[model samples]
Target: MSGNARPSLTMKSRCLLTHRAMYGAEQLGSLPCVLHTIDMLIRDDVIWLFWFDHQGVIQSFGVKFVQHTPMFLLVLMALQRFNTANWGLPNGLPHGAPADEFVKLEELTAEHSTSDSQSSSISVNWSARTCRSLHFVGRCTQIFDALVRRRDAAVAKLSFPDVSRVSEAVIVQRAREVQTAKFDLQRHLPVLHFVADVRPQMSAIREFLNITTDACVARLTIWEKLTPIVHLRGADFRRCWFELIHAHHLLWNHGIRHLDPSAANMMVRYVGGASRCPQ
Candidate 1:
């Protein structure tokens, strides 16, 4: 497996990942998994689990493999030993995986009496299972798309390269800034809330064409939908502006000069009465 050669997952791999997740009888949308990369290395395959009864991800998990090294194996063994020594504690193992989590390692067995090439390669085929349930998870993406479309349409009506309340030049600048925001969104994948899980049988690494064979681990997180001020209107719009100004002065009074505020990073949340602002 080469480090830099990441072609999209093969058709077989895609077929194997049938449901992004399986919750009871519900199988969700096409390939709900995303990749975690580090220094151009493929790290973990992140997955989200949902219940139709819940608004967003009810739970999520990541699966990663560690292989081809004794040091790594020793570390895993130490943790396993620690877990074994501490089984009576109310909490699970100190260095063990999350509760309600399990990993089904591919071909967990004695090492093959063959060359490293033959022994180290592990093939994980997930799409082979027949799912008993199906569900869809775009309620959040739908809202995001709708707001973005409305924002784009509004921006599209702006008169650029012409004189207006603000200079035509400033309008051009604003348009470019919006484009930068679009590109920024395209280049980033962000999420929240983290609970880690290491597979119980996750040590084996199988051979795959153009894939990573490194020591890696998987952790889970909550996905969030962000609201940019450009997508906001009415009182919502005014509130963001208030926050921007309030935040600026809050910094200024603290002996700091807050300059270069951009709409790109300003995320909005609605609150009432005494509010707490988290930055």
Candidate 2:
């Protein structure tokens, strides 16, 4: 594949959704099985996950994918190789994706259809045996329909100008400045978190973020979610800075230098309680 041409798992029908109450708490921890399921949903541009009860009714569980830095894969690999011995899992890897976890990937299927403006009215068709299982446990039909409705709504509300000629640096710079805290308000929408129709200067760059939008969304708002007056000691900041430098160095080694390193780009979501490190 080209540098920008990513080879993604197009269709992952087998996705196991284990019942939390049925299985013991210990068996319920890691969820590697969800990766395949998440991959399928993301590939189809379905942004959220909706879980239902045994009665085939939708319940409260809903999940949205978060995007990470461009070098997230490299950072994940390094963290796994260096810190997995001390930490439970690498930072960027899915919460439940581990061999020792013994999580089983479940299969899901649903009925869906593709429509064109010039074609006849929307014709319904049952998805293949593979795609039907997702709709079974998750109410795939409802979820898929929700996606279409949201997409159309977005189209109707679209007012931004085309941005195909802008550089990644420019777009990144603009997105970082978006500091609004409202959940549904308009602001500088980070490319990592939300998808926009702006035209990209580089096709590969567009494809890069577009393809991985689901995974990197969290990193965009993590810092914002922390306490406004987070009380980090001088030493904690130093340690985080050190890790940031290390992450940047790794990227440099890969020939991808991030020209700008603003507060927005450096992520600080540690797993444990706040620590006091020696200055």
Candidate 3:
């Protein structure tokens, strides 16, 4: 090609141009321009088309942007995964306390299962009180079982011929089940108490708990010092504490009550941090 006519751009040059186009669109603060650039990048599968040349040498063009995009996308994916993994059915009752204060726990578990699941679904019957009462050993064992079940189910689902064609509702239902199982495994399990237990195969648990507790305590101390600066009232402070550190419904079912506001109570380190009185 004549120099005056301009030489053909190489694959690497084209890839760099694509990246520059995307970067420029990102900087322009225009949604349409950004979308158009993305469309152009995907058009004719241009990036992947040039990924492997005829000589079978893998093209490493746009390596920086290509590598960084996946990592950034992975972070976004992780956040989405965490949000979905932590989801639970909304607690309609006030303060997550059961409507009947003195109801039989076993009967309530049965009733809750019936109320929560339709006839087609498999329901795990568990009372919040029972969950909170489980020993550390039992909690860990249950968590392991739940995780195993989730993994097996996922494997089975993907092994099916029609896995890709599964309905959105079915996938969502599975995710909800996995989330519920995780919640059950961790509910009412005290990290500190579990760590303090001397049992075989608990060295790792102890180490993890020590670090977690120290970090938690340090953060709590900072919050305690800052509380007065914000002038948070007793009820507001209690609510904030519960929201921050305690799972909804679990603590309420365990008979743990917020103490009246006092300097001594403020210093005491409860499972959900310092106690505050209602204003």
Candidate 4:
């Protein structure tokens, strides 16, 4: 919670706060140059949450926006909508709010599953309310907050029967390259990409979200050329392991404590052939 302890903001002020908070940070896109640029001017204490899209575009959302109305009013409208529809308030409405007022998106999970059938897609509830900022609370609690969204990248269920192209020498070389690349925020912890050419791709991905460090953290997920599965925890993975420990040290060095260091907060993704380090 903010220490200022001011009165509740007016509705209009809440709306501006919503936009200012939502648009505060630029989420990282897939481009390499974006990985290097960190824009701090746009970042502030108001942002509530961050979301990323399939193309690596990031969208930060405060409360939830419904046309021009602030989130609290929208909640009332949703309640009215549900009442008119004749749907009784379900069991899980927060504080027993009505269906329309607080629609039950789903039983919560690691990510929101869109439907029982869609395996590749996920969605999150986007609201523009005036409640206390969620991200701020998470930070106050010292939890390692993260915004994860799944992608349509290649997925494979079965292994290839043919062993025509297995080579230990190539894996060793790629692993070394992944372990040695120069990175800023997430150095040594595995999410490195080997982009032969990054300029054109950078421009294209910029539309999804501004590639600035202050907004979103970036990690390259590299797929094996022959197989869809990528490898992490390779022989050269010690660099990333040490990097994570060093980062933890620096955080404590600055007198900040991360109360939550669960596996979800410290994710490891594979690049080329090597594993990215844990958070």
Per-residue lDDT for 1-279 in model 1, tens only? 234332344465444334323432232222212111001112244222222211122222221323324544554575567542122121122222223322222222322211221212312122322221232222111110111111211010101011112332232223323322222321122222112222332112212223233322222111233446666767766755666666555445544443556676565533453222222
lDDT of 2 by residue, 1-279 (tens): 133333232224213223322221222123211211111123332232322221122222222223323344554465457443123222322343333221111111111112221112211111111121232222121101101212221110111112333433344444444343432212212222122221112123225435332111101010011211135457777665565555445445545456765554444432366642111
Q: Which model scores highest in lDDT?
A: 4
Compared with the true structure, model 2 gives a TM-score of: 0.22
Clash number for candidate 3:
0
* Model 1 pairs whose backbones collide: 16-127, 25-133, 27-133, 27-134, 121-206, 121-207, 122-205, 122-206, 122-207
Model with the higher lDDT, candidate 3 or 4: 4
**In what order do the candidates fall by lDDT, top score first?**
4, 1, 2, 3
Per-residue CA lDDT of candidate 3, range 122-216, in tens? Answer: 21212222211111111111110011111211000000011133332332233333333334413222111001111111123225435331110
TM-score, prediction 3: 0.16
Off by over 4 Å in 2: 1-193, 198-231, 262-265, 275-279
Better of 2 and 4 by lDDT: 4
TM-score of each: 0.22, 0.22, 0.16, 0.23
Model 4 — TM-score against the truth? 0.23
lDDT, candidate 4, equals 0.30
- By TM-score, the best candidate is 4
Positional deviation of residue 23's Cα in model 1 after best superposition, in angstroms: 26
